[model samples]
Target: MPDALETMKTLIEEINKHNYAYYTLDQPSLTDAEYDALYDKLVQLEAETGTVLPYSPTQRVGGELLKGFEPHRHLARLWSLDKAQNHDDLMAWHTRAQKLVNDYNTQHPDDPLPPLSFVVELKFDGLTLNLTYDRGELVQAATRGNGVVGEGILANVKTIRSVPLRIPYTDGIIEVQGEGIMNLSVLVAYNATAAEPLKNARNAAAGALRNLNPKVTAERKLNAYFYNIGYADSLQFQNHQEMVEFLRDNQFKISPFVKFVDSIDAVEEELEKLVAMRNTLDFLIDGLVVKITDMRTREVLGYTDKFPRWAVAYKFEAEEAVTTLLDVSWNVGRTGKVTPLARVEAVDIGGVTVQNCTLNNMDDIERKNLKFGLGSLVYIRRSNDVIPEILGKVTEEADGSEIVPPAVCPSCGHDLEKKGPHLFCTNKVGCRPQLVGRIAHFASRDAMDIETFSEKTAEQLYDSLDVRDPSDLYYLTFDDLIKLERFGTKKAENLIAAFEKSKQPDLASFLYALGIPNTGKTTTKELAEHYRSLEKLMQAEPEELITLPDIGGIVAESIVGFFRDPAMQRSIERLLAAGIQPVSEEAPAIVDESSPFFGKTVVLTGTLTIMGRDEAAKKLEKLGAKVTGSVSKKTDIVIAGENAGSKLTKAQELGIRIIDNEEELQQLLGDV
Candidate 1:
């Protein structure tokens, strides 16, 4: 066993490393629960052993405030916004702009309304950066740095996986301006695990961008969305929307919320829609930025000293709305945590109707002094899009009484237990909601993708065929499926076909379908790749698992928990018996010395036409070349297929040469 001092020292180092990854780099090495557990363990060990290190992660935020940045003037000066504080002010601003447009049109009605169209983009609250490229290769990158002279951060920016080091756009020379944002998911997950949680996405993003260590910035997983063509010669976009599309086509991540509007009324309507749907998006957006779409119109309107005359941000009003509270309901999610949901009479707030909002925890209820009794007035507001929060009591309850935690889960009536701030229903193996959710998730498009097994069918299968879980689906007979309501011979056959089809799913898809808590598709794929087989993954030690990127105590624990359950183990056995084959890494092909690629280990990803991936592997094997599925140090060459994802980039990052077509692959084969 490790000594107390050694253990504390190890934990401090680990946590410090994690902090650098999260706060500085934006990539979290641990899940929320895992990080919390680690922090708690460090705290406990420190208290017990009294051997705290001076540089302990528990003591301070990992990053240092930058001393200064050398300013560089932008080709096109970047400007900040002047806010229209309220809706009335926004309306007044709009009215003034409309009058100016009308006066211009009145003077020239024959000019086709001055071609006035507008594009609305979300105002992302994050750091700004400008990137420059020469002949498709990224040459320089800089922070906005007071919108004048900025720090040259090409080396640091190159480390960001999403930011293309070489511009994918075919254009000769271009300058693009964008926001580097910390993903809301990344922010939420990091905050959940931090001892000192982040205040908001903007702060998290800002902190990550300014870190002195480039490696720290690299890990932050900071994503950039290009919003402007800062300066581009010999390239002309007809409109702002076209410019946005052009940027997106060139592999730059652009805002999906952007929309083109024909008139001010349409812009207003779109803004209202965006506000209503804000709670559904997974990013922090302050408001809607409406920019005149026509390039000529934009040129005509030009810029004010510090703001765009042709563009304005329509800000959402601060949370302050009264709605009658109905009864509070407790919902048990797939993870077993019971979330408190408040059902309220639908009330319009900032031109959007909100009837129900989430109460994050019991602490939130206490904070709001929320009561369950009907006819209680409550205030609701969403801080960003993380959750719809209850602000406070709007009025003393006509029948005011504090709401108590539900003794049982509202979904399945299972007894609840308190776990920190959360209320959980410990019906892990017995819960029907979890069963449905898991089953549905397994057959989702990203998983095994059994399209025939609809949710309703799964529910019917559960009830009529006594198939309560994912394992039971494999045991289902054609007769059992045929007997169900709306089930015909064709439909039953389709279900069987889909089930049979799933039997050959790759290891990544199979693991993803298992619905293990904290094990997302990416992590599942990583696990599958690392282990190359289900048996190895099932038997993986926690120490081994914790070493994987993005996998930590919670995921390891969850994986162990899944394997530990006798029923789950039996389910795996049954699925295997039903002919399911998890994919494994293709072994290196034996190349004869005479073959062109005799010593080459060629990797392939995405769709291939000359042969299927498996068939291509066989052919390459026959040719005396090694064929693998993923790119790594051993990969001598990467033969890219259509719609190839990040693996191509990985290959490039490793300095491996890439080939595009089967003809090029053939040429490589001939090179021997």
Candidate 2:
């Protein structure tokens, strides 16, 4: 009889051989039953021996769920590529690269660099992954997070059969980077039986890679296409083609869309071809990455602060669709600024249903010749996965009826006043939409922390109780709420309790709750931090307001004008008299420079068991921190509560500081 270890090795090698043939080559050497027999034998041998190799197939079966992903620092940085949006931008990039090469050649006439040649490859729309292999063993796998340090998802990555566990190259360590994607066909198959279907392929792949459970990741049946050799200790490729060959030789999936060209014109021609057949591919690609083929040229060109100088991503134009402009509807906002919303015939842009588009005002309408575009075929485009915007009429002739401007406010029947490029409803005191919007904003989680308050509650209060302003909410009696429809005795008590509790608010939230025309949450927080008190902010001048970061001339003017209004001033005084006391950031303890949270920009994501996110934000604010809605480069720290999704993922991608545990957060907030 063969030894246990030797038998296990034989089974592992045989099974892996079949796995490579099946997964990598898209050809199975053995039948399903035959492959299962070998796999089952390997499992049995491993169980009997009570040992499993790091490269064993059984390891991919997945074990216990991980608490959190550990950060893996890559040996080399994964640089981001600069983007060229259009033909003009691409030409500009080419021009800059040629100039830089020319200058370098001029300086080194004796040993000049090779002529500029390029390789264009499809930019896969999926999560970036960096796989590290040492002595033929797949040692680690991580997401290309900040390019420096990423979350290690090795166990999750192992579930991907296409990813080789052991390579032929056993000489040294190598780090390879690629995109992890879920094929469109596989997604369709999975969705047929899935209880909750995935919306898109790109998201499915990314979500799978970021999931804590390896079993969940395995179920996605993801694929990967490696293109770049990020790092190596002993191996090196002279050019892009050579690198592609190396990746292919190692059984790595190389995208077949790679094109090599020596001239800029040839690159442009290839780009045009790619645009034609982009949608035909099984995977998703938003753009094409153009890189200098010669490794020496790339090294000589070096890198900029953010991207490599030798590579630039040529981004395709936003998806466009032609649809008939059915009608134009004018609506009044919380600030009485009336805006036109263009209603279009139902159309699909990049898989999303589009019916509504934005037409800024009279100026935009006239500029785009959209006024005469009513009932006409109009061009609408959705870019960067955002809401679609109208790109004007498709034809020159005014073939349809004109979109007439509103004479009176739709909600209040007041005369519409033209202000610069916009139409304003001067009926602020009587507009139902404006009142309801304002009341909802005031009772929002970020504003007053009014629990159980919704838009329906706001509308009901507006109609029955004649609640005109946000301050009117503070005066709502339990008796008044008890009489309303759907309001039980307990509900009335809870609402009143919420209102009374909201009377004590922080200065920043109180400012945001007012819904200043041009000021956002950031601006409101800045104002609160600088001035510390509501009275001081009310007394702020345009000059003083303009000094803060991101505060432009328009925002400063808006702040001054809002405070100057007698109605707004009177409303603020009414709230103040109603026992609403906004706590100022005047405490010396809050401004402590040594605290980690103080002066940092923070974001809170997911559900918190200890306290509400709004409560956490309030506490962070009191410690001189600014809390925001989204995660960006500017975000200093991220407080990730349980089940944190994309925001947490983005934070990890940016290598932003994350506090995943509530206890860790409690300690930080507790220390302050």
Candidate 3:
């Protein structure tokens, strides 16, 4: 029993250390298989000894479902920060802070204040969460509701792997405040099967925490980063920066891009840097938080009615504009999804003229209470400085008119279908928008690589010729293309040549060009790698697809559904009948033993001057080298180009050999 207990203790400590390294540090010493072995051993020992530690890895498994959320009062008020929109407002706030500090220094002449330095941190656009730990164990987690009272969400918060269930410190009480955010990549993956896809990461995190099922929250993969000490009974720090350092020392995740600056000018510069780096971050950050570094100064500054006076949030100017709603146009995508596009009076937002914005679907229109009227004003936002969308109705004239979805497809005049939150056109063959979109996608550079095909060409072919589907492109004669606008003898010959080239696209590109729902470039590559041929992929069952790596239930269902469709099957047969054949992606041939890059993993980063990134990767892979997306210890070489980012930094850190240009890469590959 003593031996078992000791083994369990060691395993628990080692697993927790690995967890900290993987989650908090973004570095892992142990492989996933190694970690799993240790975890399995610990579970077995704990089961035999009947001694389950509170911080055991088993406790992280989410299975509980709460009946309802209970209200809890916070120990310390989670005050909201005052916000400044522009540099002038920030300077005004700085002036006020300096005056208050000068007054305090004058009153206490013996203990005069030093020049104020500010700690600037990114203001994450997420849900504010307060966590309370008792005796080193996480006891309660709650939302920041009304600053004083909030709903308990301990079960949901515990499922977030980044939030430590138990810490090393056995302090009396430690209450920390932070933001709960959902990664953009996780959100995109989750939305593949979600009935009602979340609009943004902020709302997704908020909804996940407030969910009644903890398992659902766990599946969403929410992450948290502690930023402030709300109430700690046994901890003290001289300044906010020191408190942040203490949080980091305790294995808590904090913002990586924090800096201390002595003046408002420096703070402004940091804010500019933060804004420039915003799109590069995994999570959303709308602004920067400037807080006075001195704890003594903060004590003197105190609070206003709703916010702390010592700290201010400098928010970036919103990429939004109010525009007049003129009309709504429903467009059909390659998937037959009929999405509504709002035609608005032309207004400039962030230097771009925004005439049309996405309404998403009927559910979105209803949720925003959007009505079709000439006098109605709508608020549109360009999220992430891209993707223009109508946020909500700003002001609506008292018109009793409402925007209703069309019962028939606008292009083909066929009945439309509604599934979940989306409306779809059932006319797969005749719908102009759907056909145009599919043809355009099929001929895209990343798909079938038909270089001569364009949207205008597709439309003209659809209108004038007997072309109805992608298979029809192969049957088009040179005479047919010569009759089209701007199509002389040379252009017609080039079009025929491009069509011939597209008949034998690589397997991955052909799969992607088929317009399978929920399948992106990565999924297509995985499909090609697993099945190797189109016939095998088409015959794959959902059960078999789900067994493949990264192919979840939703993706498997989508793949099976696409192949099972009678129309899709018929289209495939027609393509085969028209002599369209796709070349399978075969394994790279083994080069001579003298080749330096043989069987080695290589990573390429930055903009290659000689060739595109994809072309470079393909070239390296063809030389018996495994091309990887990231740099690690296993990476044999990193081919870096101009303006390389984190991969280059990681390569340098790992002491991996880095080749500067294509010439160096060729030299290593023995192609020089």
Candidate 4:
């Protein structure tokens, strides 16, 4: 069949040139198992030459499931801009765009209009889209609807892998626009293994491009940028840096954040450095467009019946609101899970006030319709200092009321189970808020550092020395800390010298002070460097703890259910009968490479008071670093402590390298 239609037209132009070099040149010269073996040999030579090319890269995997959306109509008009919100609404939209460029340079002084400059960009948040193309292929996408007709969604914007299926500006028909989004670190890694998580990344990229199922918009792996060519049939430019270098020479995916600037005090100093670099952006802008770099002074400052008087946006100070829900509570944690917590009604939002939010379980309050969101009104948001979530109800008229869920353990009466979409409680050794949150996380400061232990001194040694568990604080003394209740005498010799300096520690800080549930000090330092002891990580074997590299299967079933719990083996035999030993973990530390966090990675974040971020993550894993926990873009040093929050604003939005000096972190843990 003519060499199988020239091997399906050379595997449809080499999988659309490796999906435009992995989504517009992130530069992957093939390897996702060699671009899925040339996209499974062009889907088995288009199912054995039945021939499918309509620019087939297997027609970008989305076809059978539409039945609805069709409208289209946009060859032009998409508009919607005008917003501003402050600095006297951006100096009254920069004094009405400098009096429409001084009345079109006082009635066209010989075809004038040159010096107005402007551009800016950012505004993003997500969903507008548009698309079209025609001669260079794409042919239709839509969604800005009322801006002259929309709907179409060419198979959910061809599952948006940076949206350009073919384009070198093939002579005519254009359109363009953009926005799409959903990349707050890919919605925190798709809500860390989502099972109904999404809760707002601009409504998860506008409900995954208004789904009619392009396989749920290709499982929301969406992304886009483009920046308006809004209808081009035989393109024309005259500015916005020659239309962003012709949408970067038509390979599209543009947003490298163009600036331009001329005045309006350099666009309010680039909108206060884009609201202080939109807290280290992984995408969600919501402010700063500005516009106007010419195009004949944006055609003499045009349009108003719904925006675009030469672009504006600015916005930014809402981080969501609405409020009122007013009640939900639930609580109970130290792993006996239970969660919910809504409360609401106080309000304010992006300037704090909030008053409690997080409704995270009961399948996230029945997937955020907030199972009858308490007295309704709802919505919430406030991402920065996290704890402020809710996101539902605002009159679907469920007329609020159900939230129920608690037949037991509101603090110890036991019984609550559920497990998937969570609830838990199986009172691991009689609760009292899970033994005062496991002895304030086993004397925290990265565990077992003990020093004046607190959670109100583990509820006054669990009410005057009955001290339930963390091996009964090593059978207390100095007459059980000189008879508790605010013990003095140098706080009973500093809580009996921090329980003899946490008796020998080390095996990954005694397996992260045994609060193991899905272990963390980097998976208990890779399970004490792959089971060095505590009897070979209590004789592991979740198929060798999922072959070590940070043991999975729910941390190898929470380390084989915390060492086959005979009540956690009688609290590890009364903390090894009160002596505690630990020690083991040794190998893996040859790295020096002129130190200063040698092979980087790091992370840490907030509260490090001169040491103990588990002793600065064991002196940053003996100076070779790696640390980890969250903040992505494969972190590369973060540290910052003492109230650092949101992983120090996601390491200043992934530009990384933070430190925030504790004497430059003890001169880079120099003599740890």
Candidate 5:
């Protein structure tokens, strides 16, 4: 019999060629049964010989454990939507938007009005990946890491069967955003032989995407459903939904669950049907994504730093997993801060089997007072891939023993001291876990965004480069990285290039990347705005910090404490010593009040010549009006634009006067 390694090598090459033919060319030379037999043989060989390559087909579902991902800067920001949990929240959002448009029409009586309409779609539960295509050919793929940055997983993404190597459209550079989903049937089929089964399609997709082997990614049958063309200068579409249809016509795999409705009632009915059928379908869908239909409307609605004002995601409840808490352990960090972690019996949650979850701190452990030490019943929930959090303690008899914080550091024998909820280990310089985690965070998405710096890479760098602080990243040479395992000359060069790019980031982004407690992206923005410079921020007093909006007392205190720390202060100084330029905030836009439509309440009824009803409302808003939803006496002016709807009849019956088009509104504002 051939040796296991030799058998695997042969099977891998065969399977890879067949996969390329089946997925890329849509022409399979082998039959389904024949393919299965070959795959089974490869699996059996791997099992018998214990020799598996990262790029092998068997590794596509997932691979060996990942230390962490290398960070890459996003061409455009990946903003998460502020979720609408229920009907009331959705209604409230609509009402608030209505008030803005209504106020505009009321003040500007010369503008035409049209009925407001909303477009809604499904929100798929899967890994959010951004694809950039240059001249219709796929270039790179990235995970949505921290909205502004992500991990580059091009190798794995290239293997997805549904993801086209080249889009049909060849006008200019295009950036498409969508969900990478693993079908339900494929997950079930793959899990049939596993000792543990996957929990959900979304998780399976996530795990598959992160797999090291392209062959493994291929077998998972991962598919892409393009939702929106994030950036395409050459594209022209009247509405967002129309854009999807355009992409579909261009041969891109577009989302299947999309519908247009004239009334809110129709939307509700569609949503109900979707929710009922979602579980029975071949994919996983967590919620509904709703947006204004018109493209012009979308442009006018603009966006916050995080989400588009015109769009909202109605999300469902988080999935739960029940397991046994086998044991509890505490570990101390470099700063001597101790955190409790729950060791649980493996139980599946959201398509991933989780065996452990962090208890966060001593306060969390005390609050739960968990009994499942040896075999207590426990519950887990996965939020992103950090860990399953212990929601509650179920039974005491099955509960393991009472886990307590150790007086000494778990990694080092040095003593621990309690400060607030955390127990910190006094031995700062030598703590291995702290060294690894701290270095990783410094190279994280919010920090320097080093694209090729994985946890394994960090470990390799630590022993060789002797990196102790954030500044050490700037000193890494290409030659230094090339020596590491899996780091080739080209890969090392890419890593060095990313590090160079991060040297000149905005001040807000730089501060947020610092990983300080209570100081995240939003707060970092505030600090950057208030101080305008790193030097000024560093010198600011606690009283000054407390004065800023959203800078709460606790956050203010944390900021002050962080600055006071000698270690943190030294790190900041080291970063400044490096040639990093923290950008200053530009002056805020001055809202002019002398506009003709200022304070008016506008209610649109139909479509207009220049823009859609929603788009017209937005223009009215720019002129300073409170747009409303329903027609009532509170309405100041009703713009009866083209294709007037029920709101127009109501306006006419109420004797609320209307204009003809956006031109009249503009002329009344004295622009014409």
Candidate 6:
């Protein structure tokens, strides 16, 4: 009989050759039965020898199920790319790259750098996998967890047919990063047999890779396409495109749509083509990743604490789908606007289930000729994967009933007032939905932060105890809540205690909790900063309001109009009378005028080590700095943390000063 080691070596070579032919070349050299027989013989030989090489084909059978995933420190950090939503954002990024190259050339003088180029590839909507190969042998595989550390998933990764157990080159360590994706067709087929159907291909891939059972991952048949070389000791490439070419040459799958572009206009043209081709792809793709081509330029540009400064992801437009319009329900918002919500037959769009979508106003409904009935099909679009909106009607049926505006408010049965495109309830005090929404917003974590206070509790209080408004929550006794279902003496006491504890919120939190139209968290913070007190804000005119940063004419008008309302004034008076005294603590005096961040417009991005982003922003604001979200020409400085994306790139392009670590940030803020 042949020696076990020789037999094992023969089996490994044969099986690896077969895998390469079948998976890499899409051609099978052996029948299924023959492959299985060889695989079984290899497993038997490994057991008989009592020795298993790291790259042995039999190891693909997987080991005993793990109790839990073991944490692993990655060979190299995996940073996330910053994203761009529109063509303008992409153009801004391109402009920044050009400027960086020009700056480098100017600094060197003698050895001027070449003009910048970019490589664009499809941004696969799937889980990231980092594969490490030591001396041509697959050693470890991990998922991208917080960039620095990850969970080891070597067993699951080996099950992927396209991933070679051993490569041709026997050299130093090489770490290749790719996205693990399941084809949409394969996902659908798998879901049919699966006990719990997966919602989307991306989720399915993620679930399979993370599963404790390697057999499950193998059964799913997950595939991968390598995009980057995270670490390689011996390998060298001039640019990202060259690295991709090398990966492709090594029998690794790569994105077919990869393109090398010279200008921003060319990139935009390619993006348009991608949008048209995106739906036809076998896998899901949210966007395209654009990277600087030259490795030397990338080194010069460097990285923020969290993301590389050289690349940005340009996201595709929102997806639209057609579904049966089952019914229309008019709901009242905190602003008393009665908006129609279309209850549709559940349909999958971009892997998300869409059942209910918003119809902006009565005018929007009329414009779209949206009829109420079961037969009519409505078009729904998820804008930026956040807002679900009814685009228009796909199919109109004459038998379908026409949707008409309600003469009376649905929640309060009061007369509805027609104001331009919207239908208003105007019953601010009595409207149940409005009251419930407002109360819920007030007790939310971002607001007064009344722990355990929920919308259900707010509804129960409204129906049972006549707790009509936010101020009425303070008046609730234990007896009042005890009468409601699921409410006992202890629960009622706890709720009342929570309400009492929520009597004093910060000025910004209180302002946001009021549910003022067009006033988001950022706007509220800006308003609080500019006015310092509610009394001062209420006294400010629209002209004065428009002068603050990010406060436009429309937003300014909305703020002024909200404060001017008689009912809002009464609500504020009642809240104060009920002992809700919001306070604005005085900001600390600036230590020195020499501080770089003093009175500057700064933007903070990514995960900071010293403190939370919010805490840092608050501290910066206290030091007379205005912190904004986006990076623009107006931006004076950008304080970046780990994984900071497009904003950092844009800041670099605009020649804005960037502070990386918390220590550097503190130095600029005069906190050191």
Index of the highest-lDDT prediction:
2
In candidate 4, how many Å is residue 12 off?
12
Q: What is the C-alpha lDDT of each candidate?
A: 0.71, 0.86, 0.82, 0.77, 0.71, 0.82
Tens digit of per-residue lDDT, candidate 5, span 1-672: 367687787887788777766753457899999999999999998888777665576644543434435666777777788677778777665664554455445765686233456677778778988888888767778898877777778777766755665556878877778889987778889888866666667777888788766566766778777787776767678777678776766556666678777656676687778777766767777788877676655555566446776678877656787787777877655345778777888876544567778788767766775642546677677764355788777653433666767878888677777777778886656777777677777777666666766677677777777887767778778888888787777788888888888887788888876766766676787587557788777777788787554565788888888788788888887777777777776643325578656766667665453445665665666666656655777677888754467888887888887776677776665531
Distance from true location, Cα of 616 in model 4, Å: 12
lDDT of 4 by residue, 1-672 (tens): 889998788877777877887887788886799888888888887788787877676665667776556667897889887777779877766666676677667877888787767878887877788888888988788888778877888887887877877777788888889888887777778889989877657778888788777877778788888787887868798887888888887778888777888877887887888788786877777677888788877777665457766788887765888978878878787778888788877866432356787877888787767787688798788754357787788777678888888988788777888867788898877888777888788778676766546688888788787888888887888877887665757668777877888888888877788887977787887678656788877877677886544355787987898898888788888898889998875655744658878777777875453344667787787776767677666677788865567888867977888978788788767775
lDDT of 2 by residue, 1-672 (tens): 258888888888888888888887888898999988999888887777788988898887666786556679999999998899888778877776776678678988997889989999999988999999999899899998777888899998998888888988889999989999999889989999999988778889999988978898989999988899999999887899999988888888788889999988899999999989987888888789999899988887777557887999998789899999999999988888999999899886654468899889989998998878888999999885566889989999989999889899988999989989999998878889998999999999789868768898999999999998888888888899899997878778888988888998999999999999888788888788778888888898999887555577899999999999988998898899899999975654564556678888888997554565767887887787867777877788999975578999999999999999888898888754
Candidate 4, residue 585: the lDDT equals 51
| Runs of candidate 6 exceeding 4 Å displacement | 61-63, 70-75, 84-88, 134-136, 146-150, 168-172, 188-199, 233-236, 249-251, 261-280, 304-307, 327-343, 346-375, 383-388, 392-591, 594-672
lDDT of 6 by residue, 1-672 (tens): 357888888888998889878876678998999999999998888788788877886666667776555667888799988779997778766765676677678879898766777888999988899998899888899999868788899999998887887887677899899999998889889888989887778878999899989988888888888899999888888888789877877767788789999877787888888988887998988889988888888887776546676899988778888888888888898779899888888898876677888888877876786754445877788865475888877755555677877889988899999877888998888888988888888898789888667798788888888877788888777777888897777677778888888888889999998888888998998788667799999888989887666777898898889889998888899999989988786766665566666778889886564555777887787677888887776678788876688889988888988889787776655652
- In candidate 1, what residue range of length 10 has the lowest lDDT sum? 61-70
Candidate 4 structure, TM-score to reference = 0.36
Error of 6 at 363 (Å): 11
Cα displacement (angstroms), candidate 3, residue 376, comes to 12
- Model 2's alpha-carbon lDDT is 0.86
lDDT of 3 by residue, 380-409 (tens): 887543558888887544452578788888
For all the candidates, what are their Cα RMSDs to the real structure? 29.2, 14.9, 30.8, 21.1, 11.1, 10.4
Please write out the lDDT profile of model 1 over residues 553-622, one tens digit for every residue.
Answer: 8879889888878878888898888788877766444556677666567877754544446666666766
TM-score against native, each model: 0.44, 0.58, 0.51, 0.36, 0.68, 0.60
Best to worst by TM-score, what's the order? 5, 6, 2, 3, 1, 4
